[model samples]
Target: MSENIIDTGKLVEEQSDYLLSFAMSKLQDLELAKDLVQDTFVSAITKLDSFENRSNIRTWLTSILNRKIIDHWRKAETRYTDPVSSFFDQEGKARHWLVEKKNSTSVETVVDQITREEATMELYNCIEKLPPKWRGVIASKYLEEKVSDDICKEMEITPSNLWVIIHRAKLLLRDCLGKAEFQ
Candidate 1:
């Protein structure tokens, strides 16, 4: 194979150590870092033919390893099973059941959907009434699912400021939502 062409044998020799160290730094778990690096290599192999060598091998491998690390953390953050599953069960025992769940007819379903839509619209209207700064914070933190650090950087606010803003925002939202019930 040409030096410019990717050789599967050399990919590990050239990049595994650097990729492992990078993963270890990001993930902070030696075993997990090693596993993710292995996964990175497997992914590289699967996508081998796509390599145009536009970037260097280490960069390419590092990108794959980075994605693996992110996916690991993202998966870690999510629930193993559906969270609502804890409230409803068919097995050994449960405190109660939704007596009306099975008997709801199509008209009731349509009404429920309309009610949900109206509630959502009302909440959006309430959110819009908040100050622009609080809107950004609430949207980024709750709606966009961004971390506090990113939100702080984007909003150019300190961590404490972010906390205070979110606290006040929630309080205002509660007040607004409460008022919405009357109107």
Candidate 2:
């Protein structure tokens, strides 16, 4: 048991950086990648007794890391998009009018009314109001700047699903922004 613990500790220490780098490549955020890697190791360590020896230890650890990365994506993706309230609302037409109205507002009035901090907080609150699925896709693709392929892989979605999610998310965001501006 002592030897097993030592081996596991040594393995984690040796592989943590590589695991973290891999996760970072997938996640594009240093802090979240680090957390995912750390969580992976912790989970692996806790489940060490279940090691069935059917596969290489490194493979087992990597599988755990992959799952961690996916979970992180799932959680992070939900923050950037909103749920589709009405799919047939003709977002493009509505958006053009909204932009016109917003732009017609005096620049000084806009600036005076919303400080940077307030704008950011309001934006965050709007994001929080989005439906869980739309939020995830938007967060992963737009906010995190992840490629579609990467986002799809992380979210286990197809290209069609990705496009649909993005379209709905954009509509939701536009609605949210419109509400914020009017408020």
Candidate 3:
């Protein structure tokens, strides 16, 4: 029994680098990625008895880490400040200050040629303004080029749920782009 435990421990240890890499790729924050990987290991150890052998250990650990990432994003979304109140006056009327001031003397030149990099950057900025879960769905569907079924599997959501998420994400992205003048 002790040997079996040691073997399992060794297997988990061997997977640490892969797990860290995966976390870092998804999170883009080094410290958060490290913390998430550590959390995954702790959760795996505590819940070892519950882990069925239907999937490999690496797959199970990755699933746990994915949940942690989603939880982190959900918390971030909750922390986001809504800009609606800022755009309205105390009387519930649209504030005049919300309108952009037009410059009459100097005409701004419209750039006919926008670099691909510039457009991509603008798209990313608009995507970032969306709620975190929406950003994840957009990234998985468009950036990662994953099929709907694959995205549904990865998100652990039903097909209908995946469609709903995609629909909501698209609406949010469109609103964000319009607000940011990136449309």
Top lDDT: which candidate number? 1
**Runs off by more than 4 Å, candidate 3:** 1-9, 83-183
Q: What's the lDDT for residue 121 in model 3?
A: 44
Q: Which pairs clash in model 3?
A: none
Residue pairs clashing in model 1 are: none
* lDDT: the better of candidates 2 and 3: 3
lDDT tens digits, residue span 3-67, model 2: 44647668866677656755654567898888878888888778777776766565577678878
On TM-score, the leading prediction is: 3
If ranked by TM-score, best first, what sequence of candidates would result?
Answer: 3, 2, 1
Runs off by more than 4 Å, candidate 1: 1-5, 80-183
Once fitted onto the true fold, the runs of candidate 2 whose alpha carbons sit more than 4 angstroms away are 1-6, 83-183
RMSD of 3: 17.1
Per-candidate local distance difference test: 0.75, 0.70, 0.71
Model 1, 118-177: lDDT tens digits are 456456657777999999999998889999999999999999999899899889988887
What is the Å distance of residue 56 in model 3 from its true position? 1.0
Model 3, 47-138: lDDT tens digits are: 77767576767668878988998899888876895567767779998777534445433333434233443354445656766777767778
